[model samples]
Target: MNRNILKVTLLAATLGLVSGAAFAEDYRQNPFTLTYKNAITENVVGKVNIHAVNYALNGVNIVANVYTPANYDPSKQYPAIVVAHPNGGVKEQVAGLYAQRLAEMGYITIAADAAYQGGSGGEPRNIDKPSHRIEDIHGMADFISQYPGVDATELGLLGICGGGGYSLKAAQTDKRFKSVATLSMFNSGLVRRNGYVNSQTDTIQERLKQASEARALEASSGEIRYTGDAQLTDEQIAKLPFELYREGFIYYGKTHAHPNSTFRYTVSSLLELMSFDATNNIDLINQPLLMIAGSKADSLYMTQDAFIKASGADSKELFLIDGATHIQTYWNPEYVDKAVSKLTEFYGKNL
Candidate 1:
């Protein structure tokens, strides 16, 4: 299918106007439409349960899932963690997996869809602006901190993929997060502005000009242009240059696909994305920090660069999942287990 047709299909699915055996097959096991392995099917007494939630963020209705620990008690205090989803990802994917996993480890955790993406409310859909993305993390912190039984003073953060970069920016000024962590950290701004591995450095100005034109077009005629909305064939996906993109397609497009998740973002968003860098104010985060990435991930350099520049962190550590790739850290059983174990250790001590 072409990009425009895919967009129409997505819009139809979102509006409940489309349904098929594929949708039924994908979501039959879980009423919540959670795609993770071993997802919670229902709320059982004295067991981990997920609460679907929606809250207003600057007039946009942000959709999220809050996972309460087993035998959760409202009268008692518990540390909370806010989980940010990856770019083009929804709360029901890997973010929900980690949130549920962390809740199982005895912390109240939340995973929310970012504004203009996933199930969240926003116009000019898929804006993908850095400022809005960073605020989504803060909004999650705000809501989760006030949840029943939550100890407002004890809060942690976990960002995956593109969300990792926004989390870094959020933790810089949002001191409410006492502990911060990232898995398979991806610097979205760096990659977007400079292209993956700086391969598009020569075309930076040319692309910026196109973004400017897109913005102008939108302003004058209310027309929105999108990018990165391609539907690639399996053979085409296999030929992608980067392992992150190659494996990512299999993860997000097939095995764990959710109708709400997508890659399309307004082309005009590049106006803001090109000027933003996650590591710009790295020295502002004074909390304990832990960053984990796959040792073999093509994206490892991003984690290493950010780790080295986090000079203001009270303490910091970089962990590598042996023999794992970037996307593997998201869902591979061994890698996910390793990442979660380290996160439990980090948040346990810090939060």
Candidate 2:
């Protein structure tokens, strides 16, 4: 029950490794409240337009942003892609960035805040469970496939970070996705159950016991306890074990932060997360697949592991961005451009 061990356990679950004293942009001016660079301020007549939307997902209001291609014609058919955000990430961060970029390439894209997180509605926020996260992706596919001008038969999917892991699970049987792609893909279950690169393997049972007690507390007293919420100084961030966690603090905490994004989740979520694995039944995915990761990312093993197990993919390719670490791929322009170019090619051919 040491506080530090609990903090690390929750941080691994939420994927927001560093918290406290983080910087966030003033997004009051942007109607969409987008925190990414060069976000759309206004809808141009012939340029891509972002539509803030909300819909019911199992009685909860799921908020999302759907981007329409330039000169979009409702009557014409257009392929669509669903962009899933990373763990502890909102639709306005990297998910929105990639959604907008793909829209510019003539693909209608949707980026949604997962239920219980971001702008979406859910009680006892930040659950971070595999079932709910996976359901969110499937819900997005359900909504976007019916959107105006979207060719239901030509739908594609793009998942980033933890979202990438859920996307693989959704595409496994959904099959509506003609193509599937992941960026800096993170296997949330593997990390939650085993710790980042199995760093906390020795304490797996202890954590599970803690998670059970947390769940019991929530059920009996309705008092929810959260974890992974910490206030760390610059020095602490620098000392993080993995480069991904270190850079993640700067990316989600400072360089590109949103008010809705957080690093905390109900401690009980680990009860489910501890046993979940994104790679479970991964070979069920039969569509074309493209998995992208950074050559230098400490988290690259998750991508490599999932890619190798995706034996059922009609076609599969693993592309590594040179010199890019896990978080750099989220915002660095050079790396982003390379990723977008490759995605454009992949979706163009497969979707």
Candidate 3:
């Protein structure tokens, strides 16, 4: 049997007969990247209201991109949003698009490069820490309000993928935010440690074991080995469980390749994600919430589980885009109008 087929078969078997692979799966599709030449760019633009503002949260320098609405005004304050990007992603990715789009909708939006990745500061690149990541949201709120056009009182938070998970985590404790929302919100701790919905009973244990083993090697040789993303061939890519990855190479490899994006994250730090648990404290959040995901997203279940768990969430709604997959929402124009409209309505009503 071919390796691709073998891998697919094994993954399907591992997922059991439940068809876990079928949820509006867009994991293979790369969400559209922000480019100046694109037609849409003319609709959305950003002024460097703040550049490299350093927030020493968890001993890392967090960088943020703040975008104000088209008509400038320092005389009056406006609602603000703190947007966090996806895992292994940067500020220039999909989060920036959402931030800019929301700004165009009349809100001051700030997109940040999570600490230890992209433009943010951290020694070992791509180490995901639960608390630190949550604080990054708060730090973004802190940094953005200082800008001239933002209203400190009317605040909201948005996160995509892993950042979505961290946003959920942030909202639990920081009631300072008037409204909280997520796009394809993933429970970073659960998925990173358990492989989506507690499926891998030993994921955390196994991850810890591997980290321990890697530490021993570093101790002996003073050399660190980071396990990065699994590189796949075209043949292997064709059989990816999540089509998003297969589609990703087309964008990341050709269209969006950047000098700083060669990052493959440290393998030794995979265990860091195992320590994060955003859902465990959902009962503490007391705010209006909106959870949006494609009806077909395999990752949709995680959002469902989270929306159900959050306590004191009387003002909450879960909206699913029919026929849309997880990655397609990133920037396909596939469902951008619907997603953006729904968001505008939600924010317009609550904020």
Candidate 4:
């Protein structure tokens, strides 16, 4: 059989399958360079890193990484933050970057791969349901809060991209997060249902029919169909229309490529994702909230819209990165620095 087919077949056999080839001894080495800046290495002097941590949540084993401040001691209490990765992302990308940076700033932070994706245990992998994603955030808070030296009362949350939307939902009832922050919030439901920028408004019913078919196939355990899974040539990528998808391909697929991260999600996931909206029940979140997005980012509207609807929160602010786009805020040093700075200040005041 062809390699790609073999890869998919193997993934379907079991949950938590690391994409491509057999699982490695250490996910931080060889083909897996977990961090964007490669900040983590063999000699971690002052700081501490615990990787591939397994924890049970919602009947699945979650894999996460914990980063602690220098001279970390379990006896002492310290503030903590749980970072949520973007959609189609694992914990190691931008989420790890933020977690490590926050750890450097004297906090215990964790970045966990969502169940059914990355190294986490889940069947029919890449399920990508809203409830599952939201639960992942709650689960992170559950495990990290129990970690050594974590001040459960001073916990904070930072959600990036699609994770941001789910964070809002999670924070609504999961008051364990004293403060909530989202960077480059992507309204997955709105975009999935109405299309990117509402460009597919004309095709809503048509796509729903397609999704229904996908769900039917899934029930029978038939051939699984996926969406947004593409390997594009450089020329093809350049011709893509939208900045979000175009730059995203380069970021997630090329420069930041991790064996575990893929754009494809089960097409059936749309059944739930399309009908869900992150901004629903916005009034339930009364905690300090900060939403950051690049001014040039096409997804800025989602953040702004959600921010406005967060009427129950007495303390909520929207900060925009001046010249960055959606994906640029992920790894661009200058942009990342700005985002982290705002987050540090926000968490400092709130947590």
Candidate 5:
């Protein structure tokens, strides 16, 4: 038991460079180890990390990070991947980690904060409409495709968590993404409408009513309300019943905390979220599709459901990481390595 505990502790330290306790209380003091201890930086060898890139999308200024492979040269074209961050997440967290890893694997990658959240410019901040989020993925494809040394024909896409759902919707319409992949997919629309694991089925109508009311207030220029905005103590977070929510709070609210990651969306946004379904019209995606999820993640159902609905993809696969939970796939070294290895192979074959 002692050896097992030590192994886990060693794994966490190697992934994020902070002790488990510091993950909850001293995130800021840690050495910028959101996912990996030696994340790409300006001075890093074999990789380059560009920050605060400004781009226009539907009249909004979007902030994004672009990662280029080692020894990248503009004269030489390269395959690229656009990574979409999870809901309430920023470009600097899990998205950046994958972007960096992919970059190291010889693919140019971009991870952008959604238009209305993080460091991006949008009014009534934290608005989490599905259309807007889907547009963000499309926007990344547009911006990154034109970047120097990027071969537009070989472009690929990866979306994590809620972003995974949006990617499915975006790839359905945007053929620019030659290959599409999702990690630990979260069906935001299904959850918002029926609740996690269908636990709120009885409250569906009641919750829709609240969403309607919130939208009405927004239209009338009244105070904008928000949901999923809670301030919980460490103990409270630890005691949360669901592993996804519990680990999410620790990742976005504590250990991997960033100033722009609030993890809240305007309550009115649910009006759109509830009505949007990523699996709707999923058959339009004819490109290669890869859906990855943790074997033990409760959220695996989302990936499976979406994969089943994506009938039009000529080539598709569902890969699962053994012994991992949803959030664990984000930072757990063993799981992350497995996920990235699979992604590299998928993109290498498809793109």
Candidate 6:
């Protein structure tokens, strides 16, 4: 038992470091660590440690972390939120930071690893599936509300990067979430199928060929290599597909890097993502939706496009964070604060 505890502690430390590397801070400086060690107050009310779980969602056991406000009570229920981590991110990444900060502001925030990624259960680790990813959010909502001190009635969701699009899908179909908000929303499926809005179309033949080859490689080697986001050195980062990659690494690869995380994901998953389109049913979304993107982010167009198509949304708003890049919004104090303020106000009024 002592050895087991030691092993767990060691694993936690490693995971912590990895998460710290890719996420919550400037890698050139402190990297992402447990920086919010100071006092924080929120609904549950006190300083609480992050909790991990193997939650069953979408026929899979997904890993997640819940940040309950300090001073939690058994009697009083508190408002809660489901925070979906961005693509290639886990609960311990910046997503968790957002959840923790929101909890500090008096909400029960749960950030979860998408199915088949991070500590979550999926056959092919790091595989991105739209249906299952949506289920991950719904399942998080189900799990969080069931916790003893949480108010099941007051529920909200925040999705970061690719997670944003999935959150929209969940809100549209499940309707369990009273309010939904996104930060630097990336249309993963759309981007995969058609490069960056109208950039280019990757035909089905090539997609299938890639998936088929990836599957065979997995079968022969009994190992599935991932292509999540591809890591980069400071020099390589500068030469990435887009400037966002250079910046995204600061958020997900360096500052928030978790030992369990890799920039690479399963190539086969791209096929599914290419075909996936979270905004197809945007017209069906009725709950209040807040989509925030950086004005200068090349990815901004995706969120904007999604906002324009949603037909029946009674309360919907698209915010462009001035002078911010796509990934920079994750941990940027000014950007994140602006986002949280808007989110707090929205959930306060709507939820």
Best by lDDT: 2
Prediction-by-prediction clash tally: 0, 0, 12, 0, 0, 30
When 2 and 4 are scored with lDDT, the better candidate is: 2
- Taking all chains together, each candidate's TM-score versus the true structure is 0.93, 0.96, 0.81, 0.90, 0.90, 0.83
Q: Arrange candidates by lDDT, descending.
A: 2, 1, 4, 5, 6, 3
Cα lDDT tens digits, model 2, 58-156, are: 998999999999999999999999999999999988999999999999999999999999889999988879899999998998999889899999999
Off by over 4 Å in 1: 1-25
Tell me the lDDT of candidate 1.
0.86
Query: For residues 1-351, what per-residue lDDT tens digits would candidate 5 score against the true structure?
Result: 134422322121111111233443233543543444346535465456554577999899998888888888889999999999888777878898899899989999999889889889999888888999999999998999999999999999999999999999999989989999999999888887766676556765666677787788888887887665556677766665567877777776656777677756776776787788899999999999999999999888889999999999989999999999999888888999999999999999999
Encode model 1's per-residue lDDT on 243-274: one tens digit a residue: 88777777777777788888778878889988
Model 3 TM-score relative to the real fold: 0.81
In candidate 6 the C-alpha lDDT for residue 12 amounts to 17
Q: Which one wins by lDDT: 1 or 6?
A: 1
> Native-vs-model 4 lDDT?
0.81
What lDDT score is found at residue 75 in candidate 1?
A: 100
Worst 10 residues of 4 by lDDT: 9-18
Better of 1 and 6 by TM-score: 1
TM-score of 4: 0.90
Q: TM-score: which is higher, 2 or 6? A: 2
Off by over 4 Å in 6: 1-45, 197-204, 216-225, 228-231
Write down the TM-score for model 6: 0.83
Provide C-alpha RMSD values for all models, in order.
Answer: 4.7, 1.6, 6.7, 5.6, 7.5, 8.3
lDDT of 1 at 31: 96
